[model samples]
Target: MTTEANSKSEEGHDPFFDHVPERRGTHSLKWDKYQDPYVLPFWVADMDFRSPPEVIEAVKQAGAFGNFGYGKPSPKLVDTVIQRMQERYDWTIEPSWIVWLPGMVCAFNLALRTHGQPGDEVLSAVPVYPPFLTAPANFEQKLVKVPLILDGERWTLDFDALEEAVTARCKTLLFCHPHNPVGTVFTREELQRLADFCLRHDILVCSDEIHCEMILDEDSKHYPLASINPEIADRTITLMAPSKTFNLPGFGCSFAIISNSELRARYKKARAGIVPDPPAMGLTLAEVVYLHGEPWRKRLMNYLRSNRELAYERLNEMPGLQAFRNAATYLTWIDARKLEVENPCRFFEKHGVGLSDGSDFGTPGYLRLNLGCTRSLLEEGLDRMEAAVNSL
Candidate 1:
């Protein structure tokens, strides 16, 4: 791994994050989604910032090798993951517990396949990631959407709604930690309550924790759901990746941690010839970032904190708009139900700001904005959104 220089706070201010690379015409899904060149796309979760410089340099070194072949996670990478879990989350995980995959979407889909039978049910909170909404159907299972109740500024899980929705056929609970749009970093108490609920229902949990490292609030801490206790650990499958944290989603690498031998075997069986290993380059990048990307990651969190504050303050200022003050992730969830327009997303899109439609996340009359961009770009998007809302 390449060594990083000491990152000074004063020096870290502008040069690194302020520069926005031109991504258009490069087949970037975030940039190329809109045919209109003027629209600023913030629909996807990926950041506008380039990945850590150390990671980029590693990529260059790997490319220089000139041979791309079938690859698996190196022992170093697996050991790094094990150490990270133990050190960061205080969760001790064995090497045998790891199962590598090309992407998180595939991992969760495989979770549904392994744990749920056809005609079974999968439960998840509403306004979740779009994949959680669709993965159940892909496995011929019913998706039970439980609404998350708002407690002042934060969104919390509703056990009452969950209890009402649980049924005999409920085989799996699809969970998102540092949850996608709402960005609620689960507290220990919340995790305990959720774990108890799952234990009582015997529901296998597939916790998507891809955003585990992106906590912006100093008071908030991310705990792996399985790390709550051994009982819950036996019943939970925690999915994570460096892709989201390091802006390497295009590299396509992710993993699942299943402590239960039975579940691990089942997951492997489900992924058997159908799923491919993560790309060789992706594994290389993952190892490099995990080992040497901390300084860069720290600087990133600092930058995102300001962006989150600016976004939350701006969106809430707009009439008929309310932005959730999220504890983690670079996503701001907005309530646009009170807007006079027929469609909130199109309204902003027309004004040159493209946002993820809340309807797609199973909640209509709301919008999710990506605050993972430079201040200038984010300000431009917010300005468009404000003008659009004012016209109403």
Candidate 2:
């Protein structure tokens, strides 16, 4: 290892995340799920990298006190959340409008249950994160799936289909910002159109912006739909988390910024009996990350960009395989229909590689590869995957 790899400043972040922590025996869902040490698991969205040193130190400091009792979020944490939106996205909101949750997935589920009635319809684009498909059904609401059509080199929203699919019964849309699986960050114009569509139909928009900070493009940016306009803000319930950007998913701290008092009230009411506040440690870690994790997050963005480039290059080089570079997120979606494998997940697993089955994301014959790992680990997984494909 190089000196740069071993050295860590108290305030600076290392660019190369080549270190792989020993997670096999640590009860990690991502590492231990296969029950096979040989398998390189890339199925889950979580990364293998460590959280920011600042966060780790904060956690250690909190643990030293050794009193893990019930706690409330600090005013500083609330201010940090408010400051982040304004500094990063030029968006503004009050602390009163914010509702903290255990996780981003929980935020959307709670939103669905709060806003939708039984037999009502919820709209979402296909090939989305699994939660978008299951959350509506979990709350006795019907999900109306709209496909994101392929446009040349990238996947795009089919407004014609979206407009046609809207029905009177569809009162809510669980919108995935920068979309999962497909990984396309919707543009400002595109977001405006979505806002218009939802407003025209009087549908509540639950925009999930969990991956907003993991943009691979330096020029590209994540725009919260609610931040576009006041009316849109009133209709939108945006969910975001430091978990993805700072690698704190295990901490389970995420929050929803609902500018509209009515929607916030409904969400709070629905969550009253079920949803619990994030743990004290999560709150402390969130504050540390938000305040001191910027240097680490920037380095991570650079590292993730390289992984994206390598995956984009190698996957497209494979025979009968096609992949497009995404503007955001560390996930790359591969179109494996041309490969003609009956079950790509099983096929790759046989060769010691585990990828997310596209079927789980509403897109059959496709796979989502997580690029949030070391370059060498990613290369090894892809090499094994390619060797498997060649065997067929």
Candidate 3:
């Protein structure tokens, strides 16, 4: 079915524009935690919208069978993944390379333990996802951060700075593609340069491409780090999942594509006795979404592009706010430096709008805003932000 078929109209049926019931009272991280009556949460990465009809239906069909034993990923699940890779990125992936995991965070920890030694350095570009900073330390490795350069409002990697940060002690590089917080989708040339650098330093690369399917620009294509070159693929572990794409994160299913057999063996060894198989329902829905939800996803991207436009236009009109236009992901990175507030998070909190603190992502004086909400909800948040900024 087309995404338009899924959408609801103002007077009739427009699922995309409608307000759906949020599972808040049942331990929802986005809604239940924010208790203040006036506070509007634009903080978390998850969307406020409901899952697509196709995904929900798939899960329901699986529930009908009532066989929830110790889960094993079905051959259908592997086929779905292979089909998606071939269709979306023009990259073919062998089923043997897929390593099932309960979540991407677990995979990150496993990669760190497998690739690096104690006191060895793990390099990543910041401001990045918080786990990228903490995961290395959790494995008894040092975290080396290289800041992304601000070209006007755009965030791009500083290659020279990154190369300088990589030393003999650095063993692995963790990369977030279609990056979190500041969303910058790396170009092919950029990925090639990164691969060259990693090859020169003999550093293994772990690429988190969970946001690869959520592209805002029709012209922009996500290049898997492993697919860039044979050398890089041999040294890379590429992680992806339907959780982010189909809003199935609660389902607890993510997989890593390991091209090199030796590297895969080491990774599996580190994860032994630790990582368990993904849930049966997760595998079920993952297969269903890959086969039936492509049209819905295309429409979701279109809707998200509209949301991004609305946010950018509205945010720029505010006196002291500057939002970086993102090419992918539903998150917008806004610079609030002009507000003159020493603590921007505290400043926004006082105004009843909770935003992710830029400091948390290693970039001060900026805030990340999740724009994946109904237009009315977004407008309410934007209004609160304007009041807060004006009061300052």
lDDT against the true structure, per candidate, is 0.91, 0.86, 0.85
Q: What is the lDDT of residue 205 in candidate 3?
A: 91
Q: Spell out the clash pairs found in candidate 3.
A: 7-14, 7-15, 8-13, 8-14, 8-15, 9-13, 9-14
Which numbered prediction scores highest in lDDT against the true structure? 1
Q: Compute each candidate's TM-score over C-alphas.
A: 0.97, 0.96, 0.95
Q: Is candidate 2 or candidate 3 better by lDDT?
A: 2
lDDT of 1 by residue, 1-392 (tens): 12333334342244577777998888999999998999999899989888888887878887798888888899999999999999998999999999989999999999999988999999999899998999999989999999998988899999899999999999999999989899999899999999999999999999999999999999999999999999999999999999989999999999999999999999999999999999998998999999989988888898888888888888889999999988999999999999999998998898999999999999999899998888889889988888887877
TM-score of 1: 0.97
Ranking by lDDT: 1, 2, 3
- Please give, for residues 274-372, the per-residue lDDT of candidate 3 as tens digits: 898898888877877887878778767766777788889989998888998888888999888887788888788789888898888887888999877
Give the per-residue lDDT digits (tens) of candidate 2, residues 81-129. Answer: 9998998789988999889899988899998888889999999999899
For model 2, state the Cα shift of residue 146 in Å: 0.1
At residue 92, what lDDT does model 3 achieve? 83
Maximum-TM-score candidate? 1
Q: In angstroms, how far off is 268's CA in candidate 3?
A: 0.5
